[model samples]
Target chain A: MKKLLAAVLIAIFSISALTSCGQGLSRFSVTYTDVFDTVTVITAYAKSEAVFNKAANAAHDELLRLHKLYDIYNEYDGITNLATLNRLCGESAQPVGKDIEILIKSGLEYAALTDGKLNIAAGNLTCLWHDCIANGTGLPTDEALIKAKEHISYKSVKLENGTLSFDDPKIKLDVGATAKGYAAERAAAVLEENGISDYLINAGGNVVSKGKKPDGEWKIGIQDPAKQTGEYRFIVAVKDKSVVTSGSYERFFEYGGKRYSHIIDLEKLYPSDRYVSVTVLCGSSADGDALSTALFCMSVSDGKALLKQKNAEALWIYENGEYEKTDGFKIYE
Target chain B: MNKKTIADIILVCSVVLIAAVMLIVTTVNKKNGDKFEISVGGRVYGTYSLSEDRTVDVDGLCVVRVKDGAVYMESSTCKGGDCVKHKPISKSGESIICLPNSVVIRVLGETDADAVI
Candidate 1:
């Protein structure tokens, strides 16, 4: 009985000691639903737990605000979100916030950047597939796909004096690809401006990391697309950089005895099977997030070329279980 | 007593009383389990309240239970079954790991820090 008592005491002391070691950093985090239909976690660092909580709440509020603004599905009163903007397509000039303008302008530029590989103009086509995916109605017909593709082209969107219009009447804008990344970048900046440099903002798969922990650099794990739950392919050490991953396997539906991924290809006008997943490390999460999808849909040679243009490092897991990476791609334990 | 002696006596009494009270409160609080978080691989699955006391099935491979304010890996289909061998967790930051299954259960409060790498 005495020995058992002593063991219990030892265990209690060890647990306390273990906790003290991690307590040095004073980390605060909040996880919420949606910025993009997945879980979003925001972690902030401060000298004390009290300070960390304040900053964390502020960060969460900021992200929630951004989530609502960029949302294409739902509408909130007094808020002009992407859904509303898209509804006004080719109609009277719709006024938008500065952030929306930034998203739209860059989205058009990104189309040019990837030589049209990353097409936001695929908006109307996406809506058609989106309805099918949501309702489990299976793939859209080839005729519908071909028609929807007509309204999709970066050049189809026209912006004049901060006003936006689409040349094609059927053109509908879906910023789903780049919106989260853009919001992540802007949210990180807001946290920085508020003087909290040590933070990590993960909006769905788009991550914008700023600063480091009190002990050392922040370590982030890359999720293995093939594995289910809690399985990570590897870890990456990052500070003041965003690491974003886009995996076609993340969301998929089976129809006609075959699976169709949500990540559609511009040229194929169907779910791309070029890569199981793509991870890109870059200065901006928006660029990295968009580029990861763009790269995933391209040939290895083309993906590598675009990664160079973005000055980003990437790792591509091919459909056949092959891995392709840029020369500068780095991973840590 | 003189003024200095009186002050010292009050200080000593207060410290002892506070320490004793804290020890009792903590011991009693341990009977009720706290909120704990579950994760698979590198992502958070959910945070559950231990006070509710219920069994949760983790996608069919494993079953987790929160009972009597404590959480534990009741069973798992993993070959090793090592996670099931682990003890129940009830305090902030305490964790149980099932390496074979890649499931981790941790008791957390406020969640002010970043999660596992």
Candidate 2:
């Protein structure tokens, strides 16, 4: 009987030892450069590398699909992507995929919500800025900007019965502002569907978190726009939230020693300098992305109503280094 | 006590000790990240210790310099020069990316936050 008792104790100790070995969650990360014209990094805590890789790859595939669907520059074979819609929608109603339809509808919703402050139909104006930024050329001529601005109206693009058409031939759709955040949100959903609870998806300026880390909540650092470096101006802890920032510092052109931001102001027909950067934290990354851009174009007072409508919080960083955050945003900080 | 019972007690205590040591080691290692990884075109190019300062040429596309436990892009053969203009990054998880050249230099240690946006 004594021998039996000893044997059982040893077995119990061995089992405890084994269980303790696997107690803590392991951290895994992967990076992709081919999506959304920017670097995407996915980090998570999981039981094993194999498990994380399965979920990460699935999330990556989803992002790639969204990237191709929303692409405006490249046209894939047999894919009626956004570029195709932009080219042929004016000629006739183009058959659209569900993904494109949803994205367009979401873009329109944001356009309407912001009262046209976040217009995706300003593709003509945005494309001009994109070209100048890519080629390191000077800013677009005032005459050219004004001409493109003439066609900037959200009502011109029509989506009906999974078909997209343009009432105005000059009206084009550019979803650059919301595509990354929307993709990030979708990728996070894929991770959650794979049973991965603790993960963070950083798609360039858009960050979406699904759950808290083993140690505590996930921490996110807001970049200092004036520095344009990896330095953080503030660090916030959060869980199950999406944080998105829009800044003019990342992509810009220099002309006559003056920097021109990529975000254009609708009223000025020029890049807006209202704020150096605007960051929004909310439940959906897509909403955060749109609000960040809209807030960057408008003042804090003008954006308060919009923020309250979406149940989101914001932090606006000015060029002079002054900053302001909503009351709720301070909770995470 | 019987010899067999004494041996079982010793065995249980050693197993517990080993588990404790392992837990401590892993926790300590996770807390200290003093290295950075560099990648080009989404593939890892190399990893360098931040403690050992050195200069690395990234596929003849750019120059990366690690000095005083901080890493920065010395020069790049791409337009915009944003990577070069970026400040030296010493914190774990901080990265400097050159989009035109598809070069990324990211610190590869555990950080306070999972990511910086």
Best by DockQ: 2
TM-score of 2: 0.86
What is every candidate's alpha-carbon RMSD to the true fold? 11.4, 5.7
Against the true structure, whose lDDT is highest?
2
The digit string of per-residue lDDT tens for model 2 on A1-333 reads: 675566567667666655654546788888888899888899998989889989999999999899998999989997888888899988888888888888899899988988788899999988998899888887789999989989989998998899889999878899998889889988998998987898989998899987776557888888877565566788888788899888878677888998888887777878898888888999999999888988988879889889999999999988899999898896345
What CAPRI class is candidate 1?
A: incorrect
Per-residue alpha-carbon lDDT of model 1 for A163-226, expressed as tens digits? 7777766677788888889877877777777667888887767888888875467767676666
**lDDT at residue A233 of model 1 (Cα atoms):** 69
**DockQ each:** 0.06, 0.38
For model 2, report the TM-score of its A chain. Answer: 0.91
Interface RMSD of each: 13.0, 5.8
True contacts kept of 2: 0.49
Of candidate 2 chain A, the 10-residue stretch with the lowest lDDT total is: A14-23
